[model samples]
Target: MAPSIQSLSMIHDSQECIKPIPAFSCCYLLRSCVRHASLYIGSTPDPARRLAQHNGDRYGAAKRTLRENLRPWEMVAIVSGFTSRVAALQFEWAWQNTKVSRHADLDGNATQELGVRICPRTAKEVKRVAKPRTSLTNILANLHLLLRSPYFSKWPIEVRFFSADVHRVWQVWLQRVDGLLNDGIRVVTDFAPDGISEVEGKELLAGAGRVGTLDVGYNSIKEYVEKSQFLLEDGERINCGVCKQRLILQHDIIAVCSHSSCHCAAHLSCLSSHFLKDKDSDSELVPREGTCPTCYSKLEWLTMMKEISLRLRGQAEVNRLFGRRQRAGTPKGQGLKSVRGRGHSEDENESDALQVSTGLDTVNLPPCSDGPWTIDCAIGVLGGIAHRPGGVSSGNDSDATVTPEIETHPQRCRRNQNTRTQRLGLQKSAMINLSDWYDAEVIE
Candidate 1:
């Protein structure tokens, strides 16, 4: 017997005179691109709508997963249509469990609920939806896009299968990142500021790999600056000079010392170091257990360091670039009367075109190179040194051969001088002629 038209349709028609809430069954396929897994689950009544809702941020109990990492179109294996909603829900719960769900009991949901993910339309599909290149710049750009995405902004992404597991991972990564910044330690790979790059994403994954619970101590964060290296030391608590009770801000100028009898605000770094010896000897500690010796309160070193360091570095880069552009605008033959004030001669014009900026003064860019250096700057002196692997003999400023030593080998010195002169070019001088110039702008 042919099935009724109402039973076969994707959407329900209320006027069809079908049995109330007619039950149907179907199977849906979900593949996780991030984890590279296949999930087969069943659903009831209207599978299409249910699948769509699960993928979207709005409808599914899986909304937490959807908001943070999953995208709607990523679900690759969906074959819906089930005999009943209860049966469908049961299948969904079973599929979700193929992994782990630590918080399953609290939500009153099945342990094995289906999570949304992305995948190719079929196993045979070879093309990738996103480009494979993962350079630092591209990763940062992608993070910026994610930050502005509607999904990320809507809800707190529940990445934790169990509350304790996820929270613990996040807390540790945050601590390491904070500690480095506070100590003025800059990891070149982490060149971009926090929140601006995908460091959060990378750290989240990295933290998960590290197996251990955090052992944090609440104390003042102390550092010893020795020979340009900053080392972390133990924290101590002292009294505030003004308030006269206990204080934690060890360095703040409270106008008085922690001890009421001696109103001096200073405390020996050595004295504080001794006080912290009672705590754990581990190099890293949690900021909370750490206290401001002067204020006797929790030390929030990480939050402050991340914010301050990122801002300062960001501002420095901008200022350095700005200075470069300003210097580049200077005309090519300013002081050279032979080239400019002398006459508007053809030879002078040709000489001007050959001139290029030696980007030595630009601090933001990498040291310039003859060919390897992207910026046309003087920092390329480093490149000239490489040309002669034999190494140049050095001397004083009158005959300073660029290198920091005094030696003979006048011919080598001459060669070095020529390289420097050529690299310097006419970038700093006034224009010999307008015709000699070619347009150049700083890369945005």
Candidate 2:
């Protein structure tokens, strides 16, 4: 006999419970056990499984790694915290093509080494140039350059070294580099992927110690999310600590204080602006971390962003913590799209719909704003200080001179260009009204 509707629903729920959540994308460095100099770089959602694949112990090995000489392969390091597989893939491509990639720091003169001589060389000259061999040091240097590049610097990427020797080399490079990496980027050594003890994870979460392993960090984030769920449920009305505006849980992207006892909560953009107040606003669109407006406790921007991403994907654990039930007819992995389509009007542009579906539409401004800020307005406000005509001082110093050196800094110019491009992209795609785009869905 055919199953009843209730039975089918139970079956569906059981399958959903057991369905594995998508893992975070990571880019890994692999070295042949037989030949240490032979290396490969790739990105995958499952690092352990991918390592096995490369070692020929599993099916689906890459053609280059399937050779008998490189029988066994070991992962030297893995870079995690990429938001999507596409982002990880882009990083992998950039790493693989550093000499030609715009993200790399290779000098224009260096391009001649690949065979572009004065007045242009022939094809034979290019072939005779003999491509330079990629060394471990060169790989590490490129990795450092890519992390500091404007394209990937804003991401909360982490580099985890599984090999002691490689980790040591990474440290040596860090000491030799001209500038320090952003505080948000983590460099972990001797990282254990197997998991950590619960007691140790709790200690790390409590600020008594730092997370030394991947599992411990994941557990700490999970515990923090559980705590946030309780706080969100307890409050009848939550307001942004920075902007003093009401926050709608399902509709608005919000960030909570990392301190367990601290009840500070704020809109994502408002909190980002608050943290960037002391920073070079013109050069940076995102802040690495900041003190909580209410608690004055330090918070990591990466941790907050991870929590929001998890919520957007509607992970099973997040749903359980928030006491949310998936509707019977809703398909898997479309939770974000369903939530976005709730209050969207039919007349909205396709670009706006696409932006809303990506879960970034609410990032531009607070919900209570009368009108969305245009790209030009955002640029002016974020620029911090406005210069008068003819380079005159806006301050009381009538004789103050403007330094051409500071105005013409290459790094500063590149940063300003990147920031403006990002703002323009957001303004063009996400100018819809938040109030009309999302309706508060009461959770019982």
Candidate 3:
């Protein structure tokens, strides 16, 4: 039987339930900001005591906005299975400070991290704060890391992924996942292989907290290629600097080189130059067992120069491939032809020749009307102002300045430029969300 809220005071008298908490241990707390509807993440050694303090409104801290909102069930525990308490604490702190929670959806759409399994508490019970055991700590650590990601920023309230096996769901969900991204919804969760990394997870989480719009999702270079207009010829080709082979540009083999320096084809023979150069005076080039010469930086100066040329050529090819896609009518995924099937080679020439409408075809602009504040009126006013003489408008021009000597301030101009650059930076980042492209219709 579950304990009732009324029994909390009596339960404190009992000694069997509570245990001593370890010092400097790690655990996390996520409080919902009532007014702003945003989430504030935190962590500490004693979750039970810390939560009781918040609910009791002990010090009345401003950041603790959920004092009155804590229900009996909201005092749930987050369990992690770390090998040590220190590791748990480190994971918790890193999670709160960075992309772990924010990018949860992209990390894998794990919703459990944001979970609040509230339980009744009493002041007496709170005095002895209970620390989670190892199993619980590890679980919590996983949850925290998974939740902090760009994709999971907009996670629906109260959802989390809990098992490693859940990752298989993604393989089956590929189509649905792509649709979500195309519709401007990015989901992140820690169960994802990439999302588990401490470095990437924290980076994404910090990004999401700063901007509510950052959505986390599983992303890869393959996704980029498939979604863009870069073409591949053969799937087997490798993109190593020395390889000069024709390849079907599939997701795995898109890096094969068409450059001049290390123009080896993608095959066992492609790595010969690298091996032959690196071999000792007595060593000969052995088939199927050679490392790269240029990239390894192990060969002679002349060979390095040759490798450098190959690298440059590789970069140029990459630029050209992407450039061609831009000129083509298709956006990202619609431009590239993965297999040789329809029409021509589906190269840039084909893409350029075709006409395509961008996704913003449905934007509705209000019609022009007979209003004093019309855009035309504004343009006409600007023209008249520019037509005025340098000193001041001669004869009763109400808009004319009295002083022609009021020169533009260089400092002010510089400040304005800086402001513009910052705004531009923000706008560019916002565009990555792709929110503007998505449209939902009213069923009614």
Point to the candidate with the largest TM-score: 2
Question: Can you write out model 1's per-residue Cα lDDT over 1-444, one digit (the tens) per residue?
Answer: 122345434223332432222223333333332442322234434444444555563366343335435433222222222223454464455344422323122232211121211222221212333332211112222222222233222211111111222223233333322111122211111122345334344333222211111111111211111100111113445443323444334223122222222322322232233234435555533221234445554423332232222222233322332232233345553433422111221231122232232222211222333221222222232232112122222232221121111122223323234443422332323233322222222221
Q: How many backbone clashes does every candidate have? A: 51, 0, 78
In model 3, the number of clashes is 78
User: Which regions of candidate 1 deviate over 4 angstroms?
Assistant: 1-110, 113-284, 288-291, 294-299, 307-326, 332-444
> What's the best-to-worst order under lDDT?
2, 3, 1
- How big is the positional error of residue 239 in model 2, measured in Å on the Cα after superposition? 2.9
Q: Could you tell me every candidate's TM-score relative to the true structure?
A: 0.18, 0.54, 0.20
Candidate 3 local lDDT, 1-444, one digit each (tens):
112335543533432343211222334343332221223344544444454444453443335444456321122223332323555655455555444444344344332333321112210112332232212222343443443433332222122232222223332334223223222123334432444664443332222221222121111122333232222333444443455444433212222222233333332233444555545424333322244444442222222222222222233333433454544332454212311222323444243553321111111112223211100101122122112112222344233221101122223323234444433432343212222222212111
Q: List ranges where model 3 is wrong by over 4 Å.
A: 1-29, 32-68, 71-208, 211-245, 249-252, 256-444
TM-score of candidate 3 relative to the true fold? 0.20
- Once fitted onto the true fold, the runs of candidate 2 whose alpha carbons sit more than 4 angstroms away are 1-23, 108-134, 171-183, 191-213, 216-218, 278-280, 315-444
Residue 276 displacement (Å), model 2:
1.4
Q: How close is candidate 2 to the true structure, as a TM-score?
A: 0.54
Is 2 or 3 the stronger prediction by lDDT?
A: 2
